[model samples]
Target chain A: MSKKQTKEITESTIILPEDIKKEYTILNLGPTHPATHGIFQNILKMDGEKIVEAESTVGYIHRAFEKLAERKAYYQITPYTDRLNYCSAPLNNLGWHMAVEKLIGAEIPKRVQYMRVIIMELARIIDHIICNSVIGVDTGALTGFVYMFQQREFVYDIFEEICGARLTTNIGRIGGFERDFSPKVWKKIEQFLKEFPKVLAEFESLFVRNRIFMDRTIGCGAISAEKALSYGFTGPNLRATGIDYDVRVMNPYSSYEDFDFIIPVGTQGDTYDRFMVREEEMKQSLSIIRQALDKMPEGPFHADLPEFYLPEKQDVYSKMEALIYQFKIVMGENDVPVGEIYHAIEAANGELGFYIISDGGRTPYRLHFRRPCFIYYQAYTEMIKGAMLSDAILTMSSLNVIAGELDA
Target chain B: MLISQSVQEKLINEINEHFQDALVKHEVLYDMFTITLKREAVAPLIRHLYNHEEFKFKFLTNLCGLHYPNQKNQELGLMYQLHSFENNYRIRIKTFFPINDPVIATVTDIFNAANWMERQEYDFFGIEFKGHPNLKRILNVDDMTIFPMRKEYPAEDQARKDKNDIMFGR
Candidate 1:
């Protein structure tokens, strides 16, 4: 227990000089850190301020969405999908509805398609607004986040008008929308369209040319195009890496083929490129929304599939067929054909896909959500390997790793 | 650039020719081509598809596991959805194996993205990836022994007996 005994023990241990010199500090970034933006944890092995190695730990909020989907009816699963990218809940809802529509072979009307396009574009705009502005917030500029959040609230108001909910707006039905966009909703949309562009321009101007912002993000956490693709990156992240593989463009569903928009790309695949790509994409989404509004098709909003689409309350009370249809749907007794279908949508984050396998049952036999956040999150350790700890935080914010989607 | 029916047939034929009998069954449903292949053929077939001159599915869009307890020996299955941006084609490659021996070769060598996906599959369905560098529970607790996604495991708690599925017509 004395100094002489300690010296003897150290002499016998045979410690290498390199081992002492290369000693690394282990830093736990978060299970609940403010910078993580979500509930996931990152264990970083560091040498002073530089991250030597990084390991990401997720599933702090794993709700077993797939297993839950197996028990719920086809329509019942839409609400769960809403929780997956809560920033753009309507996209998930529509994606699930479209998957069911694909399985049921329900021909969605042109009006329904246009309505979906409008809502989806709106969702895309708000999602990008959040991601790009958060990148600003991470780079020490809080003004943009505060500025753009008001626009997000306006978008949420539109969603609330469409569905009676805000955050997890289970907006649409399997066959089509639960109801058509009310006049008030249309007015809100028009208002948003009229105002959002100017606000977006103002937000972009705040950070796009700021010297400090550029210095923090331009070369920080860059990934090669091949590396990004190999890591299964999609949506804005993949497009930021210069591969223009958008699910909406490649496999157009809900009449995306009818719309005209350009996919924005970036060269460096760094934080700056990602922010720029998203910024340009927001503009494109605004244009797409304008187009959808200009070319709005006039027809029945909901499809004629009574079994999947719930009947009106008055009709259910009066008509026998409507009552039966309502009963069947509410009781989850609607016959779903045994089939396997994978429906992918260009969700705000990436390619959010629903892989559903039905077995002629009331519920899906097996359901898997190809959550883009979960797919892209695996690349985090590789991306942040040797970067500074602060740069690692910026990379995460730019990546927009939503814990709900990641753990779903 | 939707891949035409003839082009889909050609891709199927090429897959058949390249892997020869490893291709179990292929079908075009809802304009999406899906092929069920032998378990051993998955990694090589994926590699071949990745490097193919035409219909090069260089990008893996999704990977997940499925459980079919009533499928006798083929109780566990893995689905790999690949995409070719150039061809604008998406192909779903599925393979099944016995649940008792839920082991398959890892595709991380071909696609780095497959690392977490394979681990997730392992976590949910207990499908062990043979060459996975880090095979562990991802979205679930590390100490948890059961694969929660398998058909044998009930989605809800077993203790909840008050509500009956039959009463709800499920």
Candidate 2:
């Protein structure tokens, strides 16, 4: 968010003489301005209120998670993935865990699969609520944004019950969950399931049919399905373009095949379609969570790989063998496999892929995170080429470009 | 959807007939078939898959680069993941190059999404995406010379004088 880079980048454009006939005026939309929701800079050439051209610059918050992943052991990298999309940290954690589990060829149980489905669906709901309500807030519907945000807090309460943290949740293990869902946690999820739909219905009642909101969003920042596909969109953004390419449905990982759900898609890839797709997805997510909970199997939560997972506290204290294994696991002394693997999941935003190259060592040789934000953000200048400047903000919010994921 | 036996054989046969000179090997890892080839043949193969009716790899899932220092001349490699929306099958293409001159034909013309991804690859691994439209820098600052993702640089900041290896148990 430094002003230095903004001035440095825009120096050439701003120095033009005012007396000369100029059709467009250059404007720094922001590196530090509000409405971006994160540290981002878009130098826009504006013709009155319309954007003639837009050049986006990211990497303000690039912590280099890929480089960091190379130095850490398999389990140690879980906490780092949490920061990628902080709005839906648990999903990122789950994706990273499943990727490493694929590399290790570990066998996860049915109960663990159901638990992960429930947790990830909750994350998808929370992520969509944020995007949709923020869309309302951006379009001047403050009450609906506030109402949905209040409901989002309840979703956070569910996350807090599942994991200890709220924003950057470092939850789940490689093979499965760190711990099983307790009865109290299940009660909270049940309570959330019962209470959230009313608030969501109230939220929908306020905006879905409203004239002013519809006018502002429809046909604004629209892109064709072909362009969206060429730009490498996935998840809700690509679903808004009427392409049903979900990672879960296409490639079922960890027993996603057992659950029953429908993939919601929208006809036009505009702000309205993206918002409505997210709205319908929240309902589908509710159905998935209900199915997962109703048929929740009973078994061990974590996988049976003692070399990867730490032993129970009771066993670690009582048995010397358990203590030795736990010590070796923590210190990165375990034998990892030698192979090249690519694993992806439908993250809250899109397809988040982790490409790992292992040389039979404790640490990965090369770990590249195919971050969706980094790919889709490239198409921003094209999306907002000739649209109004305000619609640029709408398109960005609808796309849900997390800075952590964008710059990782 | 699961890369059926006949489709896999057809893909291999097509590559064997046309791109035999550039083909290195093909193996299945994590249940997805990965085809390794020479670096120069990547863009041509990507174009072929998109245009051919039998393959229909219309959507590019991802494009990234990696460095393996142990492989003497083949230190840098690029990986492309393509997905067909209709058939619901996936294929991965990997190509290796020498670190001293890591260059590959750009696929920006075939897949417009490759523009920034190639720039990111260039920014991190220093792999030149020849013929890229605006291949400058996407993520990192423009003035940076060193490719920070290579094995030469340490993960932690070397300027951190206060940190100790004892704290990290190194």
Candidate 3:
């Protein structure tokens, strides 16, 4: 055993020197975190408790939906829309279908338009209930979340009864809804409308004047009107900054002009203002739904475009023309007009727009969604900067940053 | 009511004067003008739209990438939907790039919202924004190789690969 031979061969271990002087901490805020609403991640650089910088890392729950939409026929993409912003599935479905209809120049009937308005408003209520209540839950108010969830469940029950699906409600087809609401469904919806206001009042009472909630929200995540405009922030988030703009009033897709409603605006564009704006919006939505239900016209629920719309199953077996039309529509043989149309709907979050380009084919040449969550999320860093870590959670919840809509 | 025909004509004249030899086409439908700028002129034109006091399209409402497989000369198009709250008018600034190299200047400085939208466009179509501060895959993972929105990359082609390989890679 010479000196070289006698040396013990220790297990090779590479101990990399840590950057001890760099006083930065990284926090991974989950692809499955509670505040995210869906699978999303944020890589946060922190100095003690303050976020120095945060980079949002999305795509954990991306369905490659836009690409998937390109592959499927126009009708097939309705379900995919449901996956995006599933909390408000009907609105997404309607927005996508309306975009397709606009591209093809398919005339939607007045009754169908009224029905769309009703369903979309209902979807807005469901979305707001979840959004407002989730903010409450995150801010240490648990009872309000339960109450709002109960109300949301009631709305989901209505959806299930009407469309045969709850979360992924592929309710509407290209020209119109899949089916007409039966008298019983209408009655149930009327009942829901009647009961919902009281529940909303209760929900409001829980958080509206609560000192703790107000303390956590007021003056936190304050975005000014100029900043909101510069960032292209739309919906309640923009309205919270006192912008008297609503896509329903501005653009008036699906005959929203017929309805009489005021666009509620907030003075200070803070977390509390956003919440208050949404609360007022829910009231407006309830009124819209009630008005739509009372004034719903009695006519065919769908358009008369046999080539594009699906024929009844009974007619498919009995009538050869119906069968042929159905086959052609399903097989992507229908000739959609060659044009591009941008249809924007006032979704629960904001402006949910569908830009469809048709090359005289059944399938869309190109389809792009203007998801509201995407716009609101752009101000995430601006909103959360200089705020406490817990304020970030509250601010995010108040913003209602739905990952499905964001990633889509 | 917000955007007069004279404004459109004035914009066309300005663009023509600024970028000689660039082809600018306007389509009027749905009470909005979709102004198609040549690829090279898009950045400067957008810059003008932002800086110009008369037009002040301060808000970049939405930016999206469109792939037209059948179009001969202009297959890959980028549509910048701009909304001016001050003027209450909307304009679409569309530009096309060749299939091989889809490159455009990052408009994040003009409109901060373009940061994520450009990232999304890059994620889907492999469109490169030359000066984007943090241009990376947004909706797609960092390790993703193929741009999903390209005409050549069909969903089925990726579906054929193993799920684990597609997501995490082999």
Candidate 4:
């Protein structure tokens, strides 16, 4: 290679901008950055420490959950929902089940509905715990995150006892739980409810009044109520903007209407408001669980949909009718009514929705998951446009944009 | 319930009176009032709903593309679910277009949230949202030619030779 040839190649490749004054320093914040907890990237054009403009580049971990849902049977898709917001897998599982039930118009037992309420509320608590504590961690308050994570583990233990799986729990069947909650599961729930509030209060005390934490989060990355609504914000993120639009309250499902709980709202739509709103929500979720436990109903655990729900193991072996039903259910050959329905639940991060179009097939004709994180991430570039780079991390964490849910 | 049957009927009648035959059909599917409209009527109808005093469907809850390869001319569809916080009501609006010219006017102008949602529709099913500022593939790579969500593309890869039954000790 001649020196002249090397110089010519360099000149051709690196053409200088026509106006050098307009050129901004381009920095890739993440496809993987220590600050970004997930596998999404932000292309930030910088003016010193402040961001002149930021472009988010996501789908690095896109798994095509919608396309896969089309090929999977109605019951088989529950596991896929678990991956969407894995911080609260049971919520996704129940949301999917509820959608299926809506399509079939199956009547759920009151006891089963109450059981679902307890489980769903527990999931909401852990979801808020992760989002709030991570915001603390992002604001350089790691002590609170470490302290709150223990409660998350206790919740996970309760989940494991109920469903035999912790993270990606394909917990409940289409109609209801596969079996009744054991005495051990009840004990664990009692234990979690008793211990969780004290630790949550301690965690809240650490950051609610701390001067440095307040300074970092209070006015940083603020958005107005109108902008948040226009951006399709929901759950805690939307409530933080003072909209108070909760799917659970607006369109109650799974006995949520029976419980009395206030939807927490925050003003200014800043990172601090988001953190505080989630903290308050966790407390509300605890109250909802307590209420569900107090007014517990006594009835069958599973709904009367033997064609959809599998029969007992011993019955399947002994009886011909049970054997036929078992084979049909296992082979995904159960009859599904032809209809189109949309069901949304007040998931941890936001309104997690499932829109199903069935053509009376063994599998769904088309299924779409309205993942709230996907919408929230689309508004990220606009949210962090003029903010400092460090505040951008705090804003993203506070929004609780789970990558699996975002990319789905 | 946020919307009663009479309110839903009145809303449908109002939409029909204003838009004429733009509303192709309307039905109540599992308590949700769904209206199928002509493609040209979608963008304007959404804007109208957003600004209407009686029905302020100002928030877009969800939007996605659908494919029906067997449905001859109308191979692609777009569904938009909008909610009115003031009334606590929701409605599903749908429009269909042929695959050869899969174009529908963008709703990003009405709802900023539709920007990425339209991009996602374009990305997966190749339904082009006209007038969108940056209409490009979102969830897929830029250079990929195939729209993965279309019915022609199977969910499982048919070309993988490594996953034969013999290899799995079956």
Candidate 5:
């Protein structure tokens, strides 16, 4: 192969007449704007109120997660998973762990699987509430935003009770949760279940049927199913296009096949449809969580594999064998099985996939994350074209563009 | 559906008839059959797959690179995962390259999704994809000095220290 140097264009002249018939304005929706949600820069070309062209630039928060995963041990990547989509950390955690577990053929207990389902559903509800509420807030609806945030605060309280951390809740370990859910935690969840529906109803009443919200979102940024699929859109964005393809239904990792729930799809595939899809999804997620809790099985919470799963803390304190196993695991002394596996889960945003390749070492040989935000960002320009500038913000917010996952 | 032995036999025969000695080896692993070919024979074989009625891999699922540090015959592996929604079947095509020089042709024209995936692979593993439209550093910054995904790249702390020292004139 030969290298060729291409010529670069420098400082092209733009001629504007004093008596211009038409005018176009460039709006820089910042790496700091409230509507951006994260560090994102969109150069919007606007003619009057309609957007002509939009260019999206990410990487303001790129931590090089793929590169980091290659150097870290398989078990050590869990915390890093929390940072991918901070809104839905458990899904990323489970995705990465399930990929590694598949590669090594680790058999987790049924109880552990149910626990994972519950936590993942909770995370999904948290993400949907925040995303939907933020969309409402961006559209100048303050009541719905406050109601949803109050509900999210309740959900975050539950997370804090389960794990020490709230936002970056690195809740689960490799094979199972860091600790079993206490009885108080179950009671708190039960209380949340009883109270959340009323708040959701309040939110829906405020924004779902409001004439102003409906007028702004009904036909704005409409995308066809064919165009969405062609652009590789997944999750709610794809579901809004009338496709009932959820990874939990299609692939069924973490024993999601055992749970029964409906995948809510949309008709018009517009901003309203996207918002409605997420709203219906929150209800479905709550139902799934309830079912998971009701059908919670009785068994070991973690896998039985001593080498992979961490031994009990009591055993680590008492038994020499357990202590040695703990040291081996913590010190990266155990050898990881060699193989490749791709595990995907229905994340709050979309299909969060972790493709792991092991070379029989403590660290992974290669790791790749199939981030849904990247594809959504790719389709952003097309989605926002010909829409009003405000509709661009509405569409982006409904899409729940997470820059951490986008620029990872 | 389980892949029938007759189908595998037919595929092998068809590949052998078309490519002659250019085909290296083909094998099935983990319920997926992979066909290995020479670098020059890739485009023709891909075209054959695309056109053949029985094997219409219309969707390019993913394209990834694998590096083997001390492998003798094949040091670097480029794997393409293709899905045929029409046939409800999938196939992986892999080609090998020497460790020192890993070059593969870009299949962006076949499927546009491969464009970003190939760029990502190139960004990390340093595998050059010839004919790629916008072959620039995607995930990393444009002026990144090292390919961070390579096994030879330094750890995070060492790399950070090196950069700091260089910037501060140590």
Candidate 6:
């Protein structure tokens, strides 16, 4: 705020109360509204139906993850990361694991890397399925949402087969996976890959060509490519604006470069394009998972580093050395390298990044989560400032602001 | 992994050519170029990088704050991650100051994305954004008196007993 900038803004964007005659009504949207999909609120000043001014309030679910990460050991922090973007919990878990591994300079085997890629892609697919189906629900198409939601259950079955949990899956360890993908898990993935596309096609046919859905989403909540970039939009939202800035493409991690897939971009960064971009990404994710599974190498599932990785249960029960190693890992006796690092992955929503500074201690000195929802949600008021109320809801759905991620 | 060595050198060269004194420190961490600067130099340097013809680092990819209590005067740091669509390169900028006088110019004037990020930094770390339009807490309660992200907050206070544990269903 310089003097010249203040003068320039006061002359252009500001309107004093005396200059306008109409009274505007303020509508509070949510700290607990169903439409928000999380616990956050917006107070919209409305002139009839058009929003005149908007004020947003977040933090209903702020658990102070960064502060908590400071005190918790690196291994203990994975469960907390699971709760950040709960829809893509495995991705968050893997992303944090990769960040810490990078700090420690721990090398993951090729098989372990491919397994990570499979799980991450599955998580991305589940994320997009929820987002796109929710867009259908927002567009008043209940059939497609119901049809596609069952597909999400299939993916969740895969998660359950891998790790015993569904939602907050503390899936993998710091170095690599806790165990190999069991035969049941492989069968579930195979079933999902075989059966999901037909359901997806049916789901898309229900919404993509429907006149009502197209009308509601095609031109609604539209943002330009430049404005989106300036507002720090990424992932499907940025791609919807025709910027092919996928983190996987830009900075490949976890052997993502080994797989070949296309990054989809949309010409118009509207609600529809956002929906379509995510749908196409889901298809690409399926393709990546196929490639990863086909090229899966044979090796030890978990990294053999006793300093960072937990030993297997059978081995720990049988061997004295494995028992001591397990005890040492569980009790946080491993040495942490003193370093500062940041790692990112193209999450279901956008670019989810973790910035960590370690001081050769069990806990990080400071940890920051670059939750994409937090950054993208900042542009909400600006994008919907002059749009209708319905468009505002559509805009939010398109942006996919998970309250968990936004408040973290 | 990182771009060519030439691109990396040219980027460093451009910054050094313009503001040698503002460049406090620089490093290549995990293949991403990281440059730290004095607190006052951040805004102008980012603005220059955004407008430079060779690298239009137009996107403010991410922004967050950090608190390092042991570092005497440099207790608080603000980090800005930038991306250039033109060149497909990324970099990080960090600036630090004392917690008692944590002040830095706002980049919200340049990128609208900085509005809530700076507010979140203020909410958690109590770092002041000097010229931000609405610099109140964005991710915490309005009347919160203490910044939670600072390292001095006691660890034992985090342990609570009333809630039901998932393991025991207490």
In terms of lDDT, the best-performing candidate is: 4
Q: What tens-digit string does per-residue lDDT give for candidate 3 at A150-264? A: 8788888888888889999999788887788878778878888888888888988888899988888899889998888777889899999999878887777898898988789
Listed per prediction, chain B TM-scores read: 0.89, 0.91, 0.84, 0.91, 0.84, 0.89
Worst 10 residues of 5 chain A by lDDT: A10-19
Summarize candidate 6's per-residue lDDT along B1-170 as a digit string, tens digits: 35567887887788789877888888877667888998777899899988898888898877888777778999888889888877788888988898889889999988988888889888888988899999898777888899877777755545577787798664
DockQ of every predicted complex: 0.65, 0.68, 0.51, 0.72, 0.33, 0.59
Candidate 6 wrong stretches, greater than 4 Å: A1-21, B1-5, B157-170
Listed in order, each prediction's TM-score against the native is 0.93, 0.93, 0.90, 0.94, 0.87, 0.92
Tens-digit per-residue lDDT, B1-170, candidate 4: 33688878888888888898898898888868888999999999999999999999999999989999999899899999999998988899999989999999999998889989999999999888889999999889999999999999888854566775775552
lDDT tens string, model 5, A65-118?
A: 777777777788889999999988877887777777877778889999988888
Which digits, one per residue and each the tens of the lDDT, describe model 2 over residues B1-170? Answer: 24878888999899889887888998887678888998878899899999989779998888889887889999998989899888888999999999999889999998888998899899999999889988887778899999989888878754677755786643
Global CA lDDT of candidate 5, please? 0.80
Q: After superposition, how far is residue B123 of candidate 5 from its true place, in Å?
A: 2.7
Off by over 4 Å in 4: A1-23, B157-170
How should the candidates be ordered by DockQ, best one leading?
A: 4, 2, 1, 6, 3, 5
**For model 2 chain A, the run of ten residues with the poorest summed lDDT:** A2-11
Q: Candidate 5, TM-score vs. the true structure?
A: 0.87
Evaluated at residue A266, the lDDT of candidate 1 is: 94
Q: List the residue pairs that clash in candidate 4.
A: none
Please give the range of 10 consecutive residues that has the lowest summed lDDT in model 3 chain A. Answer: A11-20
For model 6, name the residue pairs that clash.
A30-A41
Mind giving the per-residue lDDT tens digits that candidate 4 earns over A193-230?
89999998899789999999999999888889999889
Model 1 chain B poorest 10 in a row by lDDT: B161-170
DockQ of 6: 0.59
Q: Give the per-residue lDDT of model 3 (tens digit) for B1-170.
A: 13678888887888888888675678775546888888888878788888888878777877999887778767888998887667777888888878777888888877778888898999888889999999888877688898888878766754454556556674
Pairs clashing within candidate 3? none
Highest TM-score: give the candidate number. Answer: 4
For model 2, how big is the iRMS in angstroms? Answer: 1.5
